[model samples]
Target chain A: MAPPKRSVPDSSANGGALSLPRQAGDQRRDPSDRAIAEACGRGEAWAMELIYHRYRRRVYGLASRIAGPEDADEVAQEAFVRILRGLPKFRGDAQLGTWIYRLAVNAALTHVTRRPRHTEGDEVLDNIPAAQTSARDPGLSARLERALVALPAGYRAVLVLHDIEGLSHEECATILECRVGTSKSQLHKARARMRELLGPALAAERKGE
Target chain B: MRCPQLQRLSSRFLDGDLGAERASAARGHLRDCERCQRAVAAEAEIVAAARSLPSSPEPAQGWDVLWGRVSARVAEEERADAARSAASLWWRENRSRLTLAVSAGAAFAFVLWGAPALPALGPGPLGLVPGSSSGGDQAVTEGGPERDGVGESLAERGARERAETDRQFREAVSELEVIIAEEQAFSDGARADAAGAELGAIRERVRGAKAARVALPDTAGRPSPRQDPVYEAYWEELATLQRAAVGVSDGEPGAGFRQDPAGRAPATGPVTGDDRGGDGPQGPGGARDSAGDGEGTR
Candidate 1:
C-alpha cells in the first residue's frame, strides 16, 4: 500500500525533525516511502533519521530476538546499513515494512551464525514481546521464550515469520528464500517442537478445559 | 494420490494451490481419517500458541548506533558513486576524440616501424635495370633510391638516366676521336684528312648530346610528356651513338664494329669499353674505334 499522506516538511524549510507539527491539510504533499528511500539514497541525514524513527524499535527488536543481546546492537547496525544501501533499488512491490523485516531477519541470522553464541541467561528473558503477555503468567511467557530460542534456525525462522509475525506461508517463503511448501513444512515442525516444550504449561491450561 | 502424497501436499492445499476437486477429496479424507484431523488441529494450535509470543523491546542505544553507522556508510558510498559518475561522464564526452587519437597513434607507429625497409619494397626506376649504365666506366647511378624511397624523385631518376646516355655517347665519340688521332699520327697520307673531318662530326654529336637534358617520371610516377629536353636528350644520344659507330667502322680498327649487327647496339647499350677492332662483340667503346680506322682509309 502507498504510505500515509502527510506532507514531508522540507528539512531545510523547518530544520528537519525539530520542526513543529503541521496543522491539518497543510498544502505541501507527503513524500512516500519511495521518496524517503530516494532521499536516503542521496545520503540525506533527515531521511535516514526518518527511517530510524519509523522502524527503529521493530528492527532492533527483531535483531535482539534472533541474535540475542550480545549481537543485537551489531545486527541492528548491519541491517540499517544494508537497508540504506538497498533503498535506491527498492521497488515498492512489497511493503517497506516487509522489506525492512527481511533485512533485519537476515542480519540477525548472519550475526548469530557468525558468532555462534548459545548463552541463554538474559536473552531468553528479554526476547518476549512487550504488550501481549502483560496479563499472562510471566512463567509461561518465560517458558515460551526458552522454547523458541532452542529451536533450529530454519524452524525458528518459519515460526517467527508465519505465526508470531502473522505472515502467510507465501510471505515466509519469500523472506526465507524457500518454496512455500518448505515454509509450511518448517512451520508444522516448529509448532510440533513448541508443543513438546510447552507440554506442561499447555497441560495446565488443558486441565481447566 | 495416496494418504502420504496428500499429507505432503497438505501445506500447498492450506496455502491454496490445490484445485477444487483435490481440495474436496482431501476434505473427504480428513472427515474419515481421525489421524489427519488431529494433525490439522495440532497445526492450528501451534500457530495460535506462536502468535501469542510477545514482541520484546530492543536495547535503547540500538537505533542511535545503527543510524550513525548507516549514515556514514551511505555517505561513503555516495562519494564513491559521485566519483564513478564523474569519470563516466568524462568518457562519454571524449570517447570519439580518444578513439581517433589511438588510431592515429597506431598508424604513426606502424609507419615509423616500417620506414626502414621501404626501398626493397619499391618498384625502382630505369637505373635499377642491370645494363643501364653499360656506356660509362663508372657505375652511372646518380641519386639512387634511399631506404626511405624519397632518395630520388622521378625527376632525379630522369636526370640520372639522361646523364648515363650523355656519358655513353661521349665515351663512344671520344673513342672515335682517339682512333682518328692515331691514324693522323701514323699517316702523312690522304686518308688522314678524311679521319679529321669525321672526328669533327663525332665531336658535334658529343656537343649535341651534352646540351640535351631529359625529364623523368613526375611525383605520381607517370612519365610526363611535357618535352623539356627529355625527348631531345634521347634523340641526341641515339644520333651521337649511331654517328660515332659509323665513323669508327670506316677507320683502321673497323673489324670490331663488324662483329655482328645485333652486337652493334649503341648509346643506352653502347659498346662496353673495348671499342677497338676485334676486341669482343660486347666491347665497350671498342666497336666505334674500328669506324675511325675505316674512316681514315676513306
Candidate 2:
C-alpha cells in the first residue's frame, strides 16, 4: 500500500500519542531495526521518521518525567538529534531502545542541571500539602504527581525509571550509567524519599481511612 | 536482622532486589514488627501509585509538532554536514600544494627583504668590537639619506649607497696591495721576522673582512671604498706591513700613507699582537708576496 507514507496525522488537536492506522502486515514490509539504524546513519528521512514514531512516547515520557513537562519538548528534540547523529557509531552492543533511553535520560539530566529548580528534599515538611483522608485514596494519584516533582533529580530519575516506567534495576543501571548495586540503592532511597514526600497521603492509604 | 536494619530493606523487598536469605529475614522482621510492616506497605503504595501515574500525558500538541521541529533541525544539520564534508575534501586534495606554495612564498620573501638588512647590522653583539651594535645602529639611523617624500625609504637608499662604497673599497685595497708588493724592500734579520709575524695577523683580519663582503646578498648596500670603516682598519695594518716590507720606519712616508703616531695600529679595534703571535711562519717577503697574490686573485 504505497509503503504507507512516512507521515504523521495532523494530531496537533489530539492530546495523546499517535495511533498507527496502517493495515496489518505493515510490520512485515518494514525494515529491521538494524537496517533502520543504518538508514538513519545514512541521513535517510524515512528511517528517522520511523524511529521517531517508534520511540516518541517513551522518549517524551522519560524526558517529561526527568526534566519536567515544560522542558520535555526541547529535551526530547535534543535527544532525538543525538540519537540520529550517534546512530553511525551504534555498535549494537545494547538494544537500540535501551541505547535511545540512555541518550534521552542523559539529555534530560543535562537539561535539569542547566536549569536549577527547588526539589522536594529542599522543601520544609510543614510546606507539604496535607493528604486528604479517603478509603479509596481519592487524590493519591494527583498528590503523588506533585510529590514526584518535589523529589531531587537523582531520586526522581531512579523512581521514574524503576517505579513509574517499570524498568528492572539492571536496565535502570544501563540507562543511568550506574552499577546495579548503585541503582538498587538509589531506588531504595528514591522510594523512601517518595514515601516521605507522600507522608500523610501514604499514611492515610495504609490506614485505609 | 533488627527492625531498623530490616526497615531499610523494605524498598528492596518490594522490588524483589533482596536475596532469598535477606528476603526471608526481612519477612520475619515485618511479621513481628507492626511499625516496620506499615513502613514497607507505605513504600509499596508509593511505588504502585507512581506506576499508576499517567504515562506523561501526551504533549498537548501531540507528536506532529515535535516531528516538524526535529525534522527541520535534522535537515539543517545535514546541510551543515554536507558543507563541512565538501570543505574537508577540498583541503585534503590540495594540502600538499598549499603547503609547498606557502613555504616557497615565505622563502622568496625572506631572500628579497630579510637578507639585505644583514650586511648593515655588522657582526651583531657577538662581534669582537664592543661598540659594533651601537655603531651599526648609528650607521643605519645617521647615514640614512633624506626620504624626499617618495616610495623609497631613507634606509633603502642608505643601503644602496653603502653597497657602492663597499665595491669601491674592495677595488682600492686590491690596488694598494699591488703597489706594496712592487715596493719590495724587506728588512734584514729579526726586525723583518717580527714585522712578518704582525703582517700575517693583519692579513687574517683582511681575509675575514673579504669573506664577510662575499657573504652579503646582492641587494645589501655597499659603502664607499675609501670610507668603508672595516676595510679602512685592514688598510691601516696593510700600510704598516708594507712599510716593513719596504724597510721604512714609523717617521717615513711608506706606500704614500703617513703612519699614525701609534705606529701603524688601526684606529678601530682590529687584530692585535696577542691574536696574531706565533700563528704562522712568515718573512717580510712571505707577507708581501701573499698580499700581492690576494690582490691578483681579486
Candidate 3:
C-alpha cells in the first residue's frame, strides 16, 4: 500500500525550485509526489490526472521556451505520454518532479532537433517586454527572443532550464544528462551568444546610462 | 591580462565560474577597462531578460484544449497496451495448439515438395494391394504407345502420381496404426481412450470418402485426380492422429506407451492384416479394436 498521506509544505506555491523535497515545518496537506507516482503506476486514472495537473505548468513552460510556443502543445503532450507510460516503472531514484522535468526537457530538445528552428512563430516571446528596457528601445525583447532561437538546441536548453526556469546547474545537468561543468559552460556560451545578438540594444542602454 | 582576454573571461566571471586567480585578474581588468565593464553588464541584463520570460505561454488553443489532446493520447496508449497484453494472454493459452498447427503445415509442405522422389526409392509394404499387380505401372502401360518415361501424357502422369501418394499415405497410416495399437496396450487412461475415439472417427470418414470415390464414373478412362476431398480430410485426420500418437510416445501423458507390454521397443514396420493377430496389442483393446470394428462395418 502507498505510504499514508501526510502534511507536506507545498513549496511550489512558495516559488520554491522544482526539486521540492519534504522540508521544515509549514502546514499544507497534500500527497507526496512518490505517493502520487505510485498511484499512477497502479494504472489509476485519477492518479494520472493528478500528475498531469501537478506538472503541466512546468512541462509546458519547458516546451514553450525550449521548443518555442508554436510546437509547445505537441511537445508537452508527447512528454506527458512518456511520463504516464513510464510511471509504472518509475523507480523513485530521482524526485518525481525532477524526473518529470527531465522527460519534458528531453521531449523539447528532441522536438527542436527533429524540426528546423523557426523564430517567426514565437509570438509569446516577441510580446515579452524586457523588464529593464527603456521605453525608447522596445525592440530589445524581440531581439533577445530571436537570439535565443538562433542558439543551437542544446545551448538554448541550458539557458531555458537554468536561467528562465530557475533550475540550478546540477538540475540542468540532471535533465540534459550532461555534467554540471558542461551545463555551466553551455549557459556561459548561451549568454555570451545572446549578448552578441543584442549588441545594438545594449549599446543604446549604455548610452542612456 | 589585456582587455580582450578579460572580456573572454566575462561570461564565466558573471556566473562566478572563474577560478580565484582568474576572477581577481578579470576583476582588476574590469575595474580599469570601461568597455569590458559594459560587456559584463550587458551579459547580466540578457540573463535577466531571459529569466523574466514567462515559463508557460498560454497556448494559442488554451490549456483545456491542450489537456484534451494529452488525455486522448494517454487513453490511446492505454488501449494499445491492453491490446498487447490480451494478445500475449491468448498466445500463452493456445501455444500448444498453435505449435501443432504450424508443425502440421510444415510437414504437409515437405510432403508436397518431396512427393515425386518416392517412386525412385521403390515400394514399401503398403505400396501395392495384398493380391493386386502394380496398379500405377498398369495404368501407364494402358495409357499409350505414345509415351516415353518423361513424355507421359499429363493425365497419365497425374494419375500415377496420385496412386503413389495414396500408397504412401496408406503405408504411413498402417505404421501409425501399429504405433497407436502398442501405445493403447500399456495405456488405459482417458488420453488413450480419446485417441481411440478420434482414430475411429477418421476411419469412418476415410470409408465414406472411399465409397464416394468408387461411386464416381471414370470419364477420363482413369480417375481425374484433379480434386479429391478424401485427401483433404485424410490429411487433417492424419495430422491429428499423428499429434496424439506422438504425444503418447513422447511420455507426455502415457510413459508406458513408449515401450510394449513386454518392455521391448514396439515394432516400427507397417502392420498388415495377418500380422495384426500376432504382434498387435492382445486381449481387450481400444484404438486397434475400434479400427477393426470400422473395417468390419465397411
Candidate 4:
C-alpha cells in the first residue's frame, strides 16, 4: 500500500505559520486586566482566549482535586464559561486567579455533592506508585485516600488548598472564604487525623522491615 | 506563654502570624521547654507532610477540546454582532430618506385639500374693480392721476388737514409748557415755606445759646477760644444747615416742573402767533387764564 498522506485544509495551511509573538508583545505592554475584562464583558473571542490561557490550568487542577478525574474536565470548562458570563460583575478586590480557582472548586464540589451515592466507583489501589505501595501492605494508600475523601467537604477543601496545593494560610483562607485562624486550626487537625489513620500502617511497615 | 497561650501561639507561630513580642516570648519558652518545642516540631512536620502530597494530574484530553467549544461560541457571537451592526447602519442611512418621502406626501395632500377652499373664504386682490373697491383700495389709489380730479382734490384736502393738525399740536404744546412753569413756581413757594420753618427753629436755638453766653460773666473766667470744641461744633452745624436749606430750595423747582402736578398742560387764548401768549405772564394772575383754558379744552 502507498503511504497514507496527512490531510491538511487550505485555510489551516495558510494560517499555520502565523506567530503570536508580536500580538503577545502588544498585549504585554498593555496588560490591563480591566481591558481584558471589558473585552470579555463584550464577549470578545480573543479576550476569552486570553482569560482561558491565563487561568485554565489552575481551574482544572482545582476541579480535578474536588470532583476527581472523571468529571473534572466538564467542571473546569463549565467554570470558565461561568467566569466569562460573570466577568462584567467581577469586582476587582480579589486576584482574578483566586476568583477563578474559587469558582472552579465550588462548581466541582457542587457537582460531586449532587451525584448519586451509588455512582461512586470502587475504591482502587492499583494506580499507586511502586515506591508508595508495598507487597505486604495490601491497601494502605487506598485507606489513606479513603480517609481523606471521607473528611467533611469544608475540611477537605481547606486541607487540600493549604496542604496539598502549598498555598499560604491567607491564600487558603481567601479561596475557602474562611478566617486565617480557621484555616490553620483546620489544617492542623486534618493532618493530625491523617497521621493517626496512617500511623499504624506506617509503624507496621517499619517493624516488618 | 505556656500551655493554653502556647497552644494558641503555636498555630500563629507556625503560620507566621505571631506579633514580634509574643513570638519572641514563645521562642524563648520553646527553647527552654522541650514539651512545647516537640509540639511545635510535630505541627511543622504534619504541615510539611500535608504540603508534600502530590497534586492531581492534568486531564488526559488537552485544551484543544475546550478551545473548540470556545471558538464556536465566539464565532456565533461575532456573527450576531455583525448582523446587528449591519441592520443599525442600514436604518441610520435610510431614515432621512424615509422621513423626506413621508413629509412630501403629507404636504401634497394638504395642498390638494386647501386649494378649493381658497376662493370661498373671500375675494383676493385680483377680484375687485380697480377704482370702485372699498376703503382699502381707495386709500391705495388716492395718489394716481387716472383719478386725477379726485386725486388732486384728495391731495389738497390732506394737506389742509395736516396743517390744521400741526397748528393744534403746537397749541397743545404751548399750553403744557405754561402749566409746567406755574407748577414749578408753586413748588418753589412750598419749599420756601418749609425753609422758613427750619430757619425759625435754628434762630430759637441761637437765641438760647446767646442767652447762655450772656448769662456767663466775662469777668468770672474765660476758656481759651481754641479749647472750646462744643462752641466750634455748634457753629459748624449751623453753617451746614444753611447750606443744606439752600440746596433743597434750588432742587425743588426743577423737580416740581418735571413732575407736572396739574397732570395736564392748560390750553391758551386761541394760541395767537406769539409763543409767549400761552404763558400769559410769570405771576399768579396768569393762573386764572390757564385754569380756564384747561376746563374749556376738556
Candidate fnat values, all: 0.31, 0.37, 0.39, 0.20
lDDT of 2 by residue, A9-73 (tens): 22121223334346566441355657667877877666677678777888898888888888889
Best-to-worst order by DockQ is 3, 2, 1, 4
Best by lDDT: 2
Each predicted complex: what DockQ? 0.11, 0.14, 0.15, 0.07
**Over the full model, what C-alpha lDDT does candidate 2 score relative to the true structure?**
0.55
List where candidate 1 sits over 4 angstroms from the true fold.
A1-29, A91-95, A117-138, A204-209, B1-42, B62-298
Q: Write the per-residue lDDT of candidate 1 for residues B102-162, one digit (tens) a residue.
A: 2232233233223333454334542242222211112233334322255553334444544
Q: Compose the digit string of candidate 3's lDDT tens values, residues B1-298.
A: 8887876666677766678899889888888888888888888777766666665666788767877888788788667546432222222223223223323333332332233334533333323112222222223223232232455532344345445545555554555565556656765545555655656776786677677545543323322222334344444543445444433333222122122222222233112111221112211101121121111111
Candidates 1 and 4 compared by lDDT, better number: 1
How would you encode candidate 1's per-residue C-alpha lDDT over A131-192 as one tens digit per residue?
22232445555566566676666577666666666676666666665677677777656666
Over 4 Å off, model 2: A1-28, A122-129, A136-138, A204-208, B85-298
**Best-matching candidate per TM-score:** 2
Candidate 3 chain B least-lDDT 10 residues: B283-292
Give the least accurate 10-residue stretch of model 4 chain A, judged by summed lDDT. A1-10
Mark the 10 consecutive residues where model 2 chain B has the least summed lDDT.
B289-298
True-vs-predicted CA distance for residue B189, candidate 3, Å: 28
Per-candidate TM-scores read 0.43, 0.52, 0.50, 0.42
Q: Which is the winner by lDDT between candidate 2 and candidate 4?
A: 2
Chain A only: TM-score of every candidate?
0.72, 0.79, 0.75, 0.71
